[model samples]
Target: MAPPLDPEVLRAALVTRGSGWTEVEHHDSIGSTNARATRLGRPWVVVVADHQSAGRGRLARRWDAPPGRSVAVSATVPVPASGAGWLPLLTGLAVTEAVEATTSLAAVLKWPNDVLLPSDDDRKVSGILCEVVTARAGPLVVIGAGINVSQSRAQLPVETATSLLLAGARVTESTGTDLVVAYLQRLADRYAALVEAPVTGGALAGPTGLSGLAAEYRTRCSTLGRRVRMTRAETNGAIDVVGVAVDIDAEGRLVIDGPGGPTAWAAGDVVHVRLDG
Candidate 1:
């Protein structure tokens, strides 16, 4: 079982790791940790909030929840590798591994960037949000992560959401901080490696030149092989796209074979479903 979280203990662990973090601000409540990190203008920094007044997810959806039971953290990294667009995918993998290290449940990745738990419940326990900021120096990537640590079903806003505790995780208050920090370290290590040797071309060619990450993403993604509804930016708007998720292209785009033929989805909202349903 994991111990409870203590802010002071977390601070000491970070210091001992020699992370060279420019800042580590603990907030009672914040609109968004990613937004806060972006506005801070520093690389290798972490922002954590006990409560989020207005946490956000992809497509600007609300991600707020009660404080102290979840881990909401954001970190900023300077100009990544030449072909580092796959940072989001890599981050997802790192998060999955980190969660598994601390708990017994098997975690899976959804297309793009969501961590899902196995079982008919199909609830989302964690999510990653990536935002890019361009500067004269280069691009600054802000990666935000949220994990449901201790909330119960009654405390959840919707049935579709879940927490580690509700899922039979053994996490004490003292262990939460260590678990969060461990995950962050894993992310940092992966991010550093990506910056060093980004997947550039050849066999692993992606739309954004991060095909290796895309391939790994496919292995753990549950979105493939399911009927899906996609809302594209095109005039047609929402369309039915049902097919086995064939693969993700080098540019990190989703490739699906449907009645209309093989299509590469660049951007849109995808909801997976059972064909019979």
Candidate 2:
């Protein structure tokens, strides 16, 4: 097993002049960082684990990484109910940017929350999850993220996943600590920018808010402009649609121009398909 996270080292790495982050709890292993983070009432606090017994991804999918080869983290941030919807998208962007900047890889997002290598040779490298919690102080959003780092080919959990080591991430010299620090730093700046925008006037798409964010998301997304098989869940049941993905609207929904017509979806499993299909 890898050495557990040292709080003093993390404190030195995480300290920012004006950032409000106060506490950090590290574990060699845990059930889930997200589950633990939601139980904490304080904002700007973070939880991290080297291994997870029951880590989960979107749609309650099982997710975990090999110990010492992944970074699993969860952070709590105070946010309004209106802004809560944007956290998932924002978290996705944060992770993508952080990975690209840190690893020097052509990383991109695969809509909603998966981060991939590139469009032509795409493979999942990271996943993000955002959940809401209520406490005595108010409401908070717990953002959880996991990244495959130094794992070798034989160690990968799935055939469709890649790692920083495989991607030739030259800058990943130190360890996972650098990655956690980088991701949290970027997330902090992104969250601060979101807080500066107007929360009441739908300014999430406006200048001060997530304005150009959607466009960045679009550019880095391998889903748009490709044929996709989408499976979306509903209260009644589930439906599958095969279509050409056109755009991601300001609300972060996937716009699909399909055989029947055009539809936008908020949640779906997107499988990129060939034109022959």
Candidate 3:
């Protein structure tokens, strides 16, 4: 078991920062930090948990983190509904940077959501989920990030997942706390940029081109420039679309060229297809 988070230390490190993080709350355990933040409905607040019992991933997939083994954080930020879709991608950048900074490991995004450490067979080390909520002030996006910090390989919930420690992070008891702080700082900076950039009516979606968020996402995303097999969203079928993922369009959809032509997918399970060239 990892050392429990000291709320005082976290508060001390973050409360005075200029990130607009209004409140930082730590929990010994929680069902889901996202649920908590959504219920709170306060913008610029961060809710963190040492253990998340009912954490979820995209498509209602369960994300299991045993007590003290991972860092689960949900941060609330208000954004225009039109720009809400970019939050998850922005959060992915935050997680990638934080994990790389904290663990000294090369982290890349597996487009749409999962954060992967390439050294660990491209296994996912973190995951992001964004939920749009209606708030009195406006629209709020609860950005949830679950990062595996100290879990050993045997302790992982799946073979395709990895932790910072397993991926060569020199972790101490403060590893979880360190990751949370770094992640939130990165998120706050990126979120501010997302909010400040001008939104224009163009081929791209959201306030991306002006902000350069989409361009940055493309650089960190490993899904681009690779052949992929995507699970069909409509039928829940496997490999309905097999193509080369070429780009992320203005609206943040995955652009792929298949047997027919270039198509943009809004959401689906994408598997990188390794081929012998």
Q: Which candidate tops TM-score?
A: 3
Write model 1 residue lDDT over 1-277, tens digit each, in one string: 2233466766775645556455667776688898898888678778887667777887766786677678788888886646455678778887777777878778887777788877426688887888898655467888898888888778777778888887777776655676667777777776755555534343334443344555666777888777676676563565757666777766567788888888888666777766566
Model 2 has an lDDT value of: 0.77
Error of 3 at 212 (Å): 2.1
RMSD of 2: 2.6
Per-candidate TM vs. native?
0.85, 0.89, 0.93
Writing each residue's lDDT as its tens digit, candidate 3 over 1-277 gives 6677777777877777586887888899999999999988889888998899999988778999789888889988887435556777878998998887777799999889799998888999998888888978677888888888889889998999999888888888777778788888888887777666665663333444424888889999999999998886576675678899999876678999999899998888898988962
Better of 2 and 3 by TM-score: 3
TM-score, candidate number 3: 0.93
Please list the C-alpha lDDT of all candidates, in the order they appear: 0.72, 0.77, 0.83
* Alpha-carbon RMSD to native, per candidate: 3.6, 2.6, 2.3
Q: With candidate 3 superimposed using the best TM-score fit, by how many Å does residue 128's alpha carbon deviate from the native?
A: 0.9
User: Which residue pairs clash in candidate 3?
Assistant: 204-250, 205-250, 205-251
Better of 1 and 2 by TM-score: 2
Please provide, for model 2 over 43-93, each residue's C-alpha lDDT reduced to its tens digit, 9 standing for 90 to 100.
Answer: 899898878878888877788777777778999999854445556777888
Candidate 1, poorest ten consecutive residues by summed lDDT: 200-209
